[model samples]
Target: MSISVPQLHAELPTGCSVDRSGFMRRVSGVQAVSPISPPRSPVPLRLSVPGRLLAGGIGLGCLVILMIAGLVVPDSRGVGTHEQLGMPACGFLSRTGIPCGTCGMTTSFSLLVRGDLPAAFRAQPFGAVAGVAAGMTVWAAGYIAITGRPVHRLFRRCSATWLVGILLGAWLISWGWKIFVVVGGLVGG
Candidate 1:
């Protein structure tokens, strides 16, 4: 719980300065390979009771979603698996004759939970990626809830802009991939 921060005038390493945020930042104009500045030391994650409860709830919610996806039979057409849940057909796809961004996401999740990785990716690459992300979230949340220990705490350095930019880029690229698959008649599309 005790931290010893060097005084601002102290002889620290070149280009590194302890900022007001208590993180060692590179103040010099020397261009680093990555914009993200890692913390001087790994910070420990200790969640409060409310935080643990929230994590448990989120993990359970994701689990239920995955379970429901697994229960549904994946459409051979590579989409419309949600229709099995009494959901209506995709309005966007029905109108344009093009698969929507989330057209095969449900099918992909279903396939993934059913242990058909290849088919899941074929159904929708983004769907598979989302499934993996959700699965990881579930695991991390469960670990946090049960153990109240640090899990990948050092990863908090990346800025919100960077994280959102990466996810958005992936989503757009995956949408383009879906278009390619549909246009090329790769699947039932």
Candidate 2:
């Protein structure tokens, strides 16, 4: 396979210089955005079974931890199940008198695991979405672990900016809903 790069004249613009490969030339005047450079595969061209299993195992382990936390903790009206585990309250919430973006995520996950969809949505819509994703990841990772194959190439092809945008959008939307509910409740009561 060959990649074609556009050619420029020998006497290029003032700040343009050719790279070692003589394919890409960088111009000083131009700015490039390199937010998410695609990671070069460390694994050889031929996929290794152990590498696939290792990746799958790591993903499965994270999902298991999340599911266990959900199972053990009881979902409550507010956030800070972490406090129940002897952690401090959310400093942001304490100072601002408002919940932060991740305030109710644990409770939402717990409600989701307990099959309480409405409460999960009320707590944080993103949590329900994340819970669903965690479940799917566990299933997919389990399959890859058993079959010794990976399906990560598709994810690798996706743009990092697009994925980040989707996540931030979800969080913003969930935060807006939480604010609206809190304000509405204050007004009603």
Candidate 3:
């Protein structure tokens, strides 16, 4: 027996049926297939330039306030008033009565605020450098927000090794100086 191609294409099992156009119409009296819609792409999230500027401005403003407070608030008696204000002195060395890497930072900051560069260095050479570096960082961020351009590229290009070396050298020099002072006092006594 020869079956026509259209008949074969349209043919369905018992309890199923096909339309006259040689396509399966239904199975068990139900539609054979349902059409599906294509999936939609996700919408991208974006911040407007004005919104970015506002956020940047707020952040920079907060930083400026902090810098001003740090410089202006006097705590020269060696008793930390900033500590009560939630500013923690270095924990690693303060507990031991030994000068930590950042021991003279407050004194240095005080000297810097007073415009005494030599006194600042005498207090803690690295602290003045750190203060300037931090100020420059804030300035750069504000500059980028305002002008959409980097103010300085040296920090971006500087290597991690250079930073580590500077920090280590500063710490060792400060530690050595403290030791020398202690030794000199013992010898004099």
Which residue pairs show collisions in model 3?
none
lDDT of 2 by residue, 17-89 (tens): 6665665455656754546888997862533788767768777786875766575574364467566556788
Q: Which pairs of residues clash in candidate 2, taking residues 3 or more apart in a chain or in different chains?
A: none
Regions of model 2 farther than 4 Å from truth: 1-47, 153-157, 186-189
TM-score, candidate number 1? 0.73
Q: Which tens-of-lDDT digit does each residue in 1-189 have in candidate 1?
A: 323465554765666667675656667696545457776656565888998898899889998989999899998888899999999998987888788888889999999998888888888888998998889889988998998775655588988899899988888887777777766777643
Clashes of 3: 0
User: Who is ahead in lDDT, 1 or 2?
Assistant: 1
All candidates' TM-scores? Answer: 0.73, 0.65, 0.50
Compute the lDDT of residue 6 as modeled in candidate 1. Answer: 58
Reference-based TM-score, model 2: 0.65
Can you tell me which runs of candidate 1 are displaced by over 4 Å?
1-45, 150-152
Better of 1 and 2 by TM-score: 1
lDDT minimum window of 10 residues, candidate 2 = 180-189
lDDT of 2 at 29: 65
lDDT of 3 by residue, 1-189 (tens): 222236565335544555565555445555456458877546433345775586477558647644664655544432243464577875754576555666556655655666776655655567666656555556665656666543335567878899799788977886565445333432210
